[model samples]
Target: MSLFERFEKSFMPNYGTPPVALARGEGSAVWDVDGKRYLDFIGGIAVSSLGHAHPALVEAVSRQVATLAHTSNLFVHEPEILLAEKLLGLLKDPAKIFLANSGTEANEAAYKLALKYGRREGRRYFVAAENGFHGRTIGALSLTGKKAIRDQFGPFPVEVRFVPYGDAEALREEVTGECVAVFLEPTQGEAGVVPPPDGYFQAVREICDSTGALMVADEIQSAIGRTGHWFAHQADGVVPDILTLAKGLGGGLPIGACVGFGEAGTLFAKGDHGSTFGGNPVSCAAALAVLDNVDLEHVQKVAAQLRTGLEAIEHPLLKGVRGRGLWLAAVLTSDVSAAVQKAAADAGFLLNALQPDAVRLAPPLVVTDSEVQSFVDAFPKILTEATP
Candidate 1:
């Protein structure tokens, strides 16, 4: 049986069988089992920040594995401490961190912290935005605004109030004194890379302060230099009380973190929470290398280039482009995003249809100028062929 057929029969149907069975990948490129090379624009859904098999990441992981790999929460390790210190330095704040294994776990840790803080402060409600995705875990999923995915998993642990995204007034209304926390994504990634209006986060911060609610920013997809800035909220000059991060922080390894500022940082007492492999030494070393090797200035330049290139595409089927930095989406004139994605894949370029009208592109930070130009040149034909 074919590999795809075998996967279909054995694996759960949660993620439908992918069209291509990838064999190996290099910088900004991958080859399928049949050896057809394709420019990877999806970047493993914004997880491969340093690209496939990046030398720095490989060496760090290799060296760490050779030295030390796993040390449970029962002990402290040098790499873990260094990674935490590095993240705090980037944050530019006196904050405490809780490490985990994925974005969902990071958000979950943030949720539990908020829950405990709220209980102590006599708050009962939580506020979130519609169409904002936190993660898939039960606690994190409760904060996610998509009804289709979250509806089935009802009877959530907490009572959450959902408001319209990008509406400051609506957020203010929902984040009353009864609300303990307001969870939001600086840039909505799963919702096709939607960005809020200027000063939206500032307004949210103000309301959170007035209502005595904690502002929690879920920077899973937009953080770690994905959007030109280390954290998307930093662009707005706002510091969230609690911030969750993952997806590229480890370059490719599984790692997540929940950073709490000020009093939020100290709310979690010992034994409040813990993880077995959260701060694995090997993953921490890989993350340290990612931080060391990824050039923020170069990433910013590449992001600008990508946005400019996509916006420069003039086609009947192409409506416009949205999003900041390398995290971008080409808004289509019609609902042919899936078709365009398939067409691009057939043409040896991989893309994602985040929505019926949104084609998301989040290439690795290590993508070369030539690779980007190739995508730009192929875009017109991809859209033309996809448009019925």
Candidate 2:
């Protein structure tokens, strides 16, 4: 509470008051300021890929910082080059990478590419999905579809038409010749872990192919083994022309990437766009360690166990679960997700109330089976406490 008081006095009101002031963490648990421990299922909103203070990430970051930290894009660094190569190799495609410090920055870079692509083709429009989230920055927010966060920030710099998500025909109607790109999240993270309809990405690929528009998949929340695949779009076997990644990519360090395939890869010329700490060697090394340590098979196994347990719970407050892999939402029968989140925290677990009715659970990729089972065992009581 003292730390939160200091935070209130020193900080702005953008995030309001943080409920927990964490002191330290290990594996899948965190200790609050008063020395209470809680299972950290939120995982810094899907950024801590290997859980807190993982040895591999710590060792890599330590080793890199003692060597070289920053090159500022004026000179090249080996770690950045190696990280980019590893990403491309994972995709098994030849592409270009622009490293940044956060998800929004990556989207901003991608936004520049879309603008440049439009300049070449004389296209003036972009298409995005309704109820989708890209990021909070203006360029990224321009492509965002949530009216609550976006309404006051516009008039957006870009012209974007938003169609109902998962409605491929509606998307087809929006992406005409004037459209330069179509941006979509394979799984909507902020709109409560909502996955698109079956065959949605395939339809998106077909639409972009037919219209010569670029396909940009914003996989910021669903990438880097979160979905039991290197990228969530791979579940559908669809390839995007441009993709943005962040969250888990840096293993809790700040690193984001904007990747472009084919023409989209070579769109940027001199003075087009750049960042100083975009490819910080320390961050790149941390990301590389994450790539080296993340287990996709483990992600698949635990995700199945967690999902099956969640689905088996019999409670009136439970409406079912939404999403795939570790990114999941417990759909409530009533709008009490916030209450449930509070209750869960009190019961030594952290959960996110993504919306009024959807409580999000995005645990670390390395979360153990016992941790998941413990959460499952405690969830029903937490729900009961919050509901009645």
Candidate 3:
């Protein structure tokens, strides 16, 4: 039996069956079990920041594993401590950190922290943007505004006001004194890498201040120099009270962080919450390697090249491009993004149909200029083949 057959026989059907089984990879490229090579523009859905088989990440993880692997929050590890300090330094604020295993867990941590803050302050409501995605976890799902994934599980106890993304006035209107926090993504990654209008986050900051609501920026997809900044909100020159990160942070290993500022930073008292494998040494070391290697200027350059190349293609299916830096989307004239995605795979490329109208292109940060040009040259033909 093949890999798909094995998967069907043994595994649960949550993810369905994967189209291709990748065996090995090296720097913006991967090979399937059939030995077919493809340019990996999807970058494991924006998780492979330094591309595959990076020397730094491999060495760090291996070395740390040899030294120490799991401490179980029963003891401290140098890598975890160093990783925390480095993240706080990048944030440049007085904040506390909680490490976890995935973006969902990181978001869940922030949600729990906000609830604690709300209990003390007498404000329990939250404000979130429509089409924004937090995670699949119950508490995080309650604040997620997308209707499809959230409909089955909720009637959640938490009251979250749903508003249109990029509309600051909607936030100002919904975030009343009774609202304890507002959850936002600088760029709505799962909603097709959608970025808001200029000065939107600044307006959100002011609104949160006015209502005494904590502003939680979900940077799970937009942070760690992917947007040519350490964090996307930095582009708007605003700081959130709570920030969550994961995805690219571990360079493919599982790790996540919830960073809180000011009062929210100290909201969790002892014996409140903990995860057994949260800050394991190996993952922390891998995160450190990713941080040390991500180059902001290189990200800006590669992004510009890819954007210009995509815009230059004269295809009816492609409407335009949106997003900043390495995080980009090819907006289609028709809702044929799935066709385009399949066409790309057939043409030896890998990307994502993030929405019906948007194909997300999040190549690794280290994607070469030649690779960008190669995709550009092939994209026109790819689109031509995909058109209905």
Candidate 4:
């Protein structure tokens, strides 16, 4: 019986019992309450782009908090403006950004953008992909097609249609001119890190264009250099009318944003949408630190190397590996993902069970080749130990 026991007694059961209680983190590693060190591969679910306790992030947050910690939405902040410009600069198209506190908030804003833009006539429906995870907020959750998350949170907004992932024909058949938006994850992260079929996004873009439906890409988990690109959709050369970002955007801080490009950007007028803590100076500072450190070229090179090393791991149980850059899914032969996660934790490595048969590895952008080599060396044994 300890702090963990007390936590278990008091906390809600939504997340069940978290396996490890991390006390401190530096670079790509962390230590638990029991003083056990671990090489973090999940990067706080791809939130720590510059890794925990990065000096720049720490200094930026510190300076900003000391200067101006909280500002009401009434006043403008320089950091917020700078962050918006930086984020929009990352996109090829001119865009307007709406900041928020998390991924769901970003998606929420995107949903609002769609509705606002579609309200021009009678268009109001949103078409999303089945098994896609947007966010848990009322509006964002409405667009999320996964029944597991949406089942109990019923009585959601109407006019949402879910099509099978990567099925362009299905999307074209389901979404019509009356649909205001088409929402999808560039690569489905929560659904076992499923990558869409080649040329699939192009088809989606075509459908949205043909029907006047705005294409919305939920890059909450796939963007911010996680998949060897500023945004995953860039790799496919397909652009979306709206893009949502969070997770790694603010480095370790909490900040999310919905970016609307070209005509979509003009849909939201002043006073149309707002958030108090969305563009806080401290969070914007942290995000700037992340952007400064994460050079796209360097990340791309490192990601290619990491992928090569992971694929080189010769294990029979490792059925296959997918995804780009540090965002990867090591598919296992069986449904021992829980066991694998436990064993990896015990062995001083951190991983995630995105699905029963998929192990997600999204290490920090700063993770080195040496660390990837170490994980590759240890992976086979860990797989064996986790296997029943």
Please report, in order, the local distance difference test score of every candidate based on alpha carbons: 0.93, 0.94, 0.93, 0.89
TM-score each candidate. Answer: 0.99, 0.99, 0.99, 0.97
lDDT (Cα, tens digit) per residue for candidate 3, span 1-388: 9999999999999989878899999999999999999999999988999999999999999999999989998898899999999999998979999999999999999999999989888997999999999999999999899899998998997898899999988788898889989999999988888889988999999998888999999999899988889999888899899999999999899999999988788999998889999999999999999999998888998899999998888888889999989999999999999899999999999989899999999999999999999999999998999899
Candidate 2 lDDT tens digits, 1-388:
4888999999999999978899999999999988999999999999999999999999999999999988898998899999999999998877899999999999999999999999899999899999999999999999999999999999988799999999999999888888999999999999889998899999999999999999999999999999899999888888899999999999899999999998899999988999999999999999999999999999999999999999999999999998989989999999999899999999999999999999999999999999999999999999999985
Residue ranges of candidate 3 with Cα displaced over 4 Å: none
Candidates 2 and 4: which is better by lDDT? 2
Model 2, residue pairs in steric clash: none
Candidate 2 regions with alpha-carbon error over 4 angstroms: none
Cα misplacement distance, residue 242 of candidate 4 (Å): 0.8
The model with the greater TM-score, 3 or 4, is 3
> RMSD per prediction, one decimal?
0.8, 0.8, 0.8, 1.2
| Candidate closest to the true structure, highest lDDT | 2
lDDT of 1 by residue, 1-388 (tens): 9999999999999999998899999988999999999999999999899989898899999999999999899998999999999999999989999999999999999999999999999999899999999988899999999999999999898899999999999887778788989999999999999999999999999999998999999999999899989999999999999999998899889999999999999998889999999999999998999888887888888888877888888999999999988899999999999999999999999999999999999999889888888899889999999998
Write the residue-wise lDDT of candidate 4 on 78-128 in tens digits: 999999888878886888888899999999999988898888858968899
Alpha-carbon shift of residue 145 in model 2 (angstroms): 0.7
Q: What lDDT score goes with residue 307 in model 3?
A: 94
